[model samples]
Target: MPKSLHPDICDKLRFSKLYEKYAQTLSNILLYKYGDILNPSDKVQEAFIKLWENCTKVKPEAVKTYLYTTANNMMLNEVKHQNVKFKYQQIKPKDYTNESPEFVMRKKEFSNRFEQVLSKLKEEERVAFLMSKVDGKTHKEIAETLGITKKVAEHRIYAAMKYLKNNLEELNKK
Candidate 1:
């Protein structure tokens, strides 16, 4: 037996009306069910787009279910990605524990904080600073690699360092 009372949702008029009727409600449901970790509005839009693409295939009755399932999967994929990221980033403590646990904990905290600040830097600044500090590149080398002027490269490195210094002032003092 057919699931929906209405026919297929291929007609543009029917699809538009269906979208208007259910879009906000679906967004609310996704946010409530899945939390705000991912943007529910974007997920809802994607789901609707999928339905529209497969409108000829999906019966009008199943549109709601199809949308929710697609959006839910998308949200779950993002959550899964985050979990995998944390899993790989998980710190493994040394079995010997030569350093005190307190020291290790403090080190990890500082490392995480430093990473946060570093990630917040602008792309140009971060790239210049990393090349200088991590790769031991000179300002001229950085300029050649980035195709920027030496002064611009030096300025980016300085700016990045200033930002890091300001944000990590407490750590620098200690």
Candidate 2:
């Protein structure tokens, strides 16, 4: 934890050299992993800032892992927040042949009600559920992205499904 890197570490991670060597590569990795869901450039910048703040504590050899892990965690949190906020706002009807007006209206009504129920779920449960159901992520994938155990991911999704089912049934009864 030296304020200035020791000579050996400095060779690998001099402040200026660090960005030149690693920034674009890290950004590319995050972009590939997250697609358009996150701003890779922004996440990369944030990770660099964190790296700078913890420079003394981070070993030069481990800097790449540190940067990637930080950026990935940042992107995951941003994706979860944005996914929830943007979910219902961007709904679009799929193309269908000769649908009746009543059917269309009913579909919209059901969608709106489902969105309401989803919004009422606990944040962790909602995130897990949407990641699994909407994004087509498996429990293992969701666990990795969210930095949780697979068991936790499974429980969260199950809890979310139970809530949605019970609430939707109540809505239907009404």
For all predictions, the C-alpha RMSD in Å is 16.0, 9.4
Write one digit per residue (lDDT tens) for candidate 1, span 54-173.
988888767777887899898888788878888889767657768899998898898888978987898778877877886677999778755689999999999999999999866568
lDDT per residue for candidate 2 within 69-113, as digits (tens), equals 899899999999888989768867677758898988888888889
Number of colliding residue pairs in each model:
0, 0
Q: How far is candidate 1 from the true structure (C-alpha RMSD, Å)?
A: 16.0
TM-score of every candidate: 0.46, 0.46
lDDT (0 to 1) per candidate: 0.80, 0.79
Worst 10 residues of 1 by lDDT: 28-37
Error of 2 at 60 (Å): 9.5
Off by over 4 Å in 2: 1-98, 170-174
